[model samples]
Target: MSATLGCFFLSMWLMRRRETVYGWFAVMSVAWWICGYNQVATSPWPFRSTDGWEIANTVSLLVYSASFTVFILRFCDGR
Candidate 1:
């Protein structure tokens, strides 16, 4: 939790620098944070025996994957 907050602050500071890579990295960090939260919230057995966790996990993974891919491409292409 503290780590996430630290990353958030770092991202904010980086944003002020007006760098494209930092912006993309911030976005990726946000996606990662969301995915981590979802996992923790649904871990150690769900409150209800449903597919909600599976669905949320899938969606989070997709978002994380897409953001990371974009970040890598943008960084590599010097966006």
Candidate 2:
């Protein structure tokens, strides 16, 4: 976990990404990775679980989904 966290922070620093919507895409991916890690750690047992981790993971995925959809539409359509 420490190594993962260290790599994440190091990558962020090395990236130095701008504050554009594209940057938000990277953020979304990172957020999803972290939240998904949490889900894996918790094992997501039982359908009765209603933790915030699930919500976060869902939201992060949604950001990526929407962004990728937009990218496909604009880039593919040449518009």
Candidate 3:
């Protein structure tokens, strides 16, 4: 679902280049997807250890929060 939303928003941004909110929304969606996947995955295939996985997950969550805030602020014309 998050992937689909991210792709859809990305395509929307591509079609309407002037609307930057869509781009931010796409970023937020992709970050959310990464976080969600990290929560549900069985193993951390790419990471060498649990510490790396945790760090990556934490970074993704931070990205998700930042992007979501940006998306909301942009959508509301707050910036």
Tell me, by lDDT, which candidate is best.
3
lDDT of each: 0.64, 0.55, 0.93
> How well is each residue in 6-64 modelled by candidate 1, as lDDT tens digits?
47756775767764556556666766676677645635355354477667667767876
Clashes per candidate, residues 3 or more apart or on different chains: 0, 0, 0
Model 2 lDDT per residue over 1-74, tens place:
53354456547645774423344344445555655666457555443466755776687678757755654554
- Candidate 1: count the clashes: 0
After superposition on all C-alphas, the RMSD of every candidate to the true structure, in Å, is: 4.2, 6.3, 0.8
Residue 4 alpha-carbon offset, candidate 3, angstroms: 0.4
Off by over 4 Å in 1: 1-14, 37-49
Off by over 4 Å in 2: 1-50, 77-79
The candidates, ranked best first by lDDT, are 3, 1, 2
Put down candidate 3 lDDT per residue, 1-79, tens digits, no spaces. 9999999999999999999999999999999998999868888879988889989889999999999999999999998
Q: Lowest summed lDDT over 10 consecutive residues: which window, candidate 1?
A: 41-50
**Which clashing pairs does model 3 show?**
none
